[model samples]
Target: MEKKDGSIDRKYIPILVLLFMGAFIDGLDTTIVNVALPTMAMDFDVSMSNSTWIILGYVLGLAALLIPAGKACKNGRVKKFFIAGTLTLLIGSVVCGFSKEYAFMVVFRTVQGIGAAMMSAAMPSIIVRLLPPDKKGIGMAAMGGASGVALILGPTLGGFVVGVASWNWIFFINIPFGIVLVLLAMHCLPKDGVPDPSKDPTPLGAVSVFLTVGLLLVILQNYGDKDQGVELMIACSAGALVSLIVLIYSIKHDRERAIISTKMVLNRDYILLGSAFFLSTMMLTGTQYVMPYWLQISYGMSTMESGMFLTISSVAMLTIVFWVGKLVDRRGGRSSSIAAQLCRLVLCIVMIVITPPDGLLILAAAMVFLGFSQAFSGTGHTTRMIHHATPGYEDESTNFLLVINYAAAAMGAVVYSMIIAITLPETTLLEIADYTVRMTNDAVNFTAVAGIAFLVLALVLSILVPNRVPDKSGKASEASDAPDNASE
Candidate 1:
């Protein structure tokens, strides 16, 4: 069953497929509803502000449940929860498609979010648990690549689906894939690993919910034209601030028993990995969120034309993740990440000189490079994070890494929004469609600066990444680590 490289046998392929299925759905679910919001709001007879909850509710659910669901993975219940989560999402998606009321839609979406949290939290731990060091990056790559592709394709695909079919069809699309994935996961994932769960939920869970959800709400308010009012936003922001203080206090008081441990809090490598993920995501989302508007507004391109440009960019990213994952496996995290970061840095620097019409072809070329860097660096960071996953807290480590990604993306949206607001005349996202070329050009200029700063920060962090995981024993443990993955 062993390969000459001291990796697991080919049997892991089916397991990898199952894992990717979940990951892809999780990524797609995040953005698939975005393009359909306007139609959905009208169909449900709700204002755009109220309809926004459909997105907010799902995101809050995801943030609230991530840590708790991750904690559940600690006990040998990862497989149990994984299967349960897939089923929950499957059912929830179908129900969401059938919803007759906005409340029902929100509730179903929340259910899907809970399920996604479990799958996302459990996946990295399971991947690390299964693959040997030599092949581990490839495994993580499968996940990262599937997710990256989904993120790229979701909005475009959602719009196409909505144009041809009802918005409900978007939710329905998951049913067949979810059903097959659930079955494969149930049958193929290694027998459940040893569960080492604590009985108490502790104050940490509630605090995390408050901090993550509250901050997300505040971010959402600023990230868009949602005028939820100054007072309400202030209240949400205050709640989030208090929650952070409570989290710090808990970590300080109960380092060992706390969900957020001092070891994790203070670890240098973990901090670097988190920074790399956060900053890289900020660059990605900031650019991606702006590019479509920049194209449509600045060049007077149609929606479909701008979408095609993005698709080309995404296709490039989609192609690179696969091979970069293998490169990560061979080169190790530090080298791969550093190289990837450098590539991204070059792309951002080049993007500064790009303008509409005269620079369209050049921009497309830059996008190709952008996609490549996102994939390579993304896979590298993922590989390192998984390889360095804390022994006793594999789930927690992965959970925190993913949370950093989420937070960074939200931050990117808010940051880009602030830049645009400061640079351009006031315009809602809905109204931004009609923005003048001058307004769009201003947004692009500001976005480019922000992207450059983020990439620079990420590059510095990547330099600090340990080239490879330190094998303290300094001997081949490949054979030894093999069986542990099967039963640990």
Candidate 2:
């Protein structure tokens, strides 16, 4: 749907809503499921460690399928993909709610993750192809806002649901929501044109890419248990290395038909923005991985209290991203991104130098800054990446964002945990003594300093982004010719 007199078309509203819902449910599932894991473990009679595979199952599916799914969308079958994805997710959610065995639940969750990968792959392309140039920021902001809402609500909502009802409601609740989203998809999404078979990626390239990402994810997720996972990590590392070698060979042999073209990977703007995203995501996830425990130990707050406090950052993030997104539309992503990194740099400094307080005042202030930095970077980096995407390579840009995001999350958690473990090897929260508290605070500060390295790198990358990049020309894929179908 095209803009009229510089305003977004009225018909695109439902499409926008559908996109928001898609991102919301995906994000909500992420946080909500984490909250319900304990309950799930008890119900399934599995150890907490084994129950984690419920989450890992989903992650593995997404990692394995993301490359293939992204390649599929490059041909512009977004509407078909969205419909099928929503249906797949719905089926997975339904089965998960009624699952009688732990193995079945993990399998169902994997099915759910495959669906999420498809939908995630399509959302940005839909925005890039369907929304007018001036309105793309708004679309991104709406999706960001939905994610923010999910982040803020997921824990609280999950707690409420599981406290009063069975953990199964978490999955069951998605059924009606999924049905509605599916109907919206059929009605609101634009139709696609004929796809070019030649544009499809080679099977070898797809498989290799999948192996690289999937094995890496496995290693990152389990690396924390050094005692139990040493062998597994080594095997996965070898597998990932071999997969990477194959991926490189395949790309060199057939750059045109590879899952990720050499041109796309080597593009100056793409690498800069992508590296910045990687660093920023790494910092955000790393700090978050350690922050809650730090808060609890240093401040003597309960788990619930710490979680509620963290929502402050989510609220701040939600509020700022929309404004930053609008700024992106009016000015450019480069400036917005620079400003965000600067804020992060300042926050990191504050965390390092400021003395730990007995009260929450300093920590609360830090959360606000953290939120602002995250919002600015998230909106700016993504919007700029889209703007700088090589004309016909917009789908690849989005796919790269998803890939780095997942990788950064896994890496951040593992890396930060290691840092904390090294710094406070003997510290325990079970003791409420002053000495233990001081040690935890020291560990947190050291982690923040490490985070600065990432933020600095992100800042450098943001600076490297050119003031302007070539805008994507008219869409090349099948999605280009279908504004009217959205109305139908």
Global Cα RMSD, each model:
5.3, 6.3
Q: Estimate each model's TM-score.
A: 0.83, 0.82
Show model 1 residue runs off by greater than 4 Å. 1-8, 31-59, 91-111, 151-156, 166-168, 191-200, 223-228, 252-257, 300-304, 346-351, 388-391, 429-433, 469-488
lDDT of 1 at 396: 78
lDDT of 2 by residue, 294-411 (tens): 6656676544555577677779889788787766665557776777777677666776776655536766887788778767767767777777777667778777777777667656
lDDT to native, each model: 0.67, 0.71
Q: Can you write out model 1's per-residue Cα lDDT over 1-488, one digit (the tens) per residue?
A: 23668565777878678767888888777666755665676688764334555665565566667666776665577788788888888788889989999889988888887787777777866765665545666667777777777766776776677777778888877777778877887788767766654532356745666465647555564644544567767777777777777776765665554666556556777788888878887777666656655666677655445555666656787887877776655555666676666766666766678676668887778778777776776687766775565555555787777777765655665667666655552544334334577767767787788888887888888776565542322111221112222211
Task: Give me the runs in candidate 2 sitting further than 4 Å from their true place.
Answer: 1-8, 34-57, 94-109, 165-168, 221-226, 292-304, 345-357, 421-443, 469-488
Q: What is the lDDT of candidate 1?
A: 0.67
> Ten-residue segment with the worst summed lDDT in candidate 1?
474-483
Candidate 2, residue 440: the lDDT equals 67
